[model samples]
Target: MKKILVVDDEFDILTTWRLILEMEGYEVTTASNGRVALESARANPPDLVITDWMMPHMDGVAFIRELAANDSLAQVPVILMSAAAHAPTLEHGNAQFRRKPLSIDDLLDLVKHKLGEA
Candidate 1:
């Protein structure tokens, strides 16, 4: 099974994602913010990460950079989601962008694509 770390400050969003991903057979781990997510990832690197852009205590961009800094985690792909009017720059080649209100089917497909299981 593929492991996915989901980072979001909102508990409801986190829970929803966990349930959805779990039902699809992905081993889901969730963090409330980038800081916690980074720590967790370092301890046990996941296959992929799904994160919200505007989290507190280290945002998505900063988290991606941190992961990139580590040789072991740099290559891990990420899907960054945001509700902002203007999209944030996604410079990480291994990272992808998704706007808020993304459909569940789209999210699942993206996850599969990222994991090379599509």
Candidate 2:
């Protein structure tokens, strides 16, 4: 099974994503902030990461930079989600962007595409 790490400041959002992804047969892990998420990723690197742009302690972009800095985790695919009016600039080629209020179907499709299961 593909492993996914989902990070969000909102506990409700994190829980919702976990349930949705798990139901799709993906092994899912979640963190409430980027700092915790980064630690989790280092401990057990995930195949893909779904993160919110704005987070306490560490932001998604910073987390992605840290993740990419690690040789072992550098290749992990990431999906960045934000509700902000303007999207943040992302230079990583392995990253994809999605606006907030993301549709479950769209999220699943992106995950599948990233994991090459689509």
Candidate 3:
């Protein structure tokens, strides 16, 4: 089973994404803040990561940089979602990005595509 780690500050967003991704038969884990996200990722790296840009401790960019830097976690694909449309330009390599308020279908499509199952 493919694992997905979702990092978002909003509780509702985390729950909603968990439900949606779970229903699609993907194993899902969530972190409410960037600090927790880093710990979780280091503990059990996911096959894919979907992270929000603005978080209290680590922020998405730093998290991605860390992930990319680590040899064990660097192969995992990332899908960055943010309200800011400028986020995609900030990072490069093996990532899919989307704006917020995307439908479940679009989210799943991106996930599937990133995982090379689409």
Against the true structure, whose TM-score is highest? 2
lDDT of 3 by residue, 62-114 (tens): 78878877788888898888888575454436776678888888998888887
Candidate 3 positional error at 111, Å: 1.0
The alpha-carbon lDDT assigned to residue 49 of candidate 3 equals: 91
Error of 2 at 97 (Å): 1.4
- In candidate 2, the residue pairs with backbone N, CA or C atoms under 3 Å apart (3 or more residues apart, or in different chains) clash, namely none
- Give all candidate RMSDs, comma-separated: 1.4, 1.3, 1.9
Candidate 1 C-alpha lDDT tens digits along 75-95: 999999999888777657698
Which pairs clash (backbone N, Cα, C closer than 3 Å) in model 1? Answer: none
What stretches of model 3 exceed 4 Å from their correct place? 88-92, 116-118
How large an RMSD does model 1 have?
A: 1.4
lDDT (C-alpha, whole model) for all candidates = 0.90, 0.90, 0.83
The residue-level lDDT of candidate 1 at 110 comes to 91
Candidate 2, residue 90: how far the Cα is off, in Å: 1.8
Candidates arranged by lDDT, highest first? 2, 1, 3
